[model samples]
Target: MEKVIKSSDRVKDHGEVFTPKRIVNLMLDQPEIQSKINDLQATFFEPSAGEGAFLVELLKRKLKVAKNKSVSAKLFNTKSLLALSTLYGIELLEDNVEMLVMNMITTFNIEYSNIIQEKFGGKVNQHVFDSAKVIIQANMVQGNTLEKITSDGSPIIFSEWKPVSGNKVQRTEYTFESIINQSGPTGTVQGATEEMDLFADTDFFADLQKKEPRMKKYALCGWTSIYKQEIV
Candidate 1:
């Protein structure tokens, strides 16, 4: 077992072993998985992103592709969003979670800086960096995946970020259970009464609207611009 944490007591308690870099790379080198390493729209999920070993490699590969496709900051940021936003991870320990976020955003900023200097004559907007940080913060979380509950005891929920027209992004939140039910091998939303209805497909918004929380939907602008400070 690879011991990432120095404390043996904590390791015993949390089983916090991290996969070594060599193993991680070997596993990701499989032809099918390697093919999509730089595919901007492809998604990645790491259950325990300890210091983001695998995730960092993913960012490196994706940013390499983005660097190649750098025509302008606008086009590059829009495409880079797909690569950055599609990554998701859940870490039980808060420190691990924070580290994972740091790992991701730092890699993002460094890569963005490198590519801009190499291809775009070092002229780029700060908003692009802000956008990457925002996406990384939202994507990684500290939570118990087995329990599938947020810290507040609510069902785990993840937001989907979609790039809309006019350089804006649309965010849609969905319950973890709902997402699995929709995509599971069962190939059907066939489940108990607590589950979302398959019949609700046609009237999706109506059902979603009637729900207690009123499905969280938001549109974020300012992505078209360069980052000055923070995410709006």
Candidate 2:
């Protein structure tokens, strides 16, 4: 229930009207949607994630699976991390973006902390916490979905964060156009005008859109590293 209706002037200015939770649930409760959303690896996108009301419910639904009797800390962390990472959002207002990020991240952290304390009486692993934070930071972006670019005019590149070898995660970035193209390199691809093996990372497609010579073909960047200038 997140009703932040602005003045008529503001509404006219931005076309902003919050969707009531009742409607959100009715729309999302379809049999197919219920099945798919329950899956731990499923991805969701909300181009207009006002204060993340939808995301909050989505996270709650997914965390039920993480709360099983014999669940390990690793299981909880991975499942929860995947749930958050798989969510993609684009918000036009900076304040709304901040609220969305804070709401979602805080929900995850608090719920995750409680689950671990009750189940295992232990604190969250730093690696897992940092990894989850990074995923939230990258997945919930500030941009215009229609324009498909950030406020700074960079292509809205969404990163897929996956659990890789031995507890670390691999992040593969994809532009909005690349993701919806259907016939491009869907997951991580080597940068060349040649073939690369494909794997499903959500429903996104990607390509080796060339630019510079310095960046490696399949390099993973640090949490705050700028995108390679070539992708510009």
Instruction: For candidate 2, write residues 178-221 as lDDT tens digits.
Output: 67764343523233223333453532243323221122233443
Structural similarity to truth (TM-score) of each candidate: 0.77, 0.74
For model 2, what is the alpha-carbon lDDT of residue 175?
A: 69
Candidate 2: segments with Cα more than 4 A from true spot:
163-168, 183-232
Compute the lDDT of residue 83 as modeled in candidate 1. 72
lDDT digits (tens) for residues 1-232 of candidate 1: 5656658886899887777878888988898887787577678888777788899888888877766676776677676766777788888887888889998988888887777777777565677777788778777877778866555444556767766777666666666657766753222222323554857645766544333232444546545432222232
The residue pairs in collision within model 2 are none
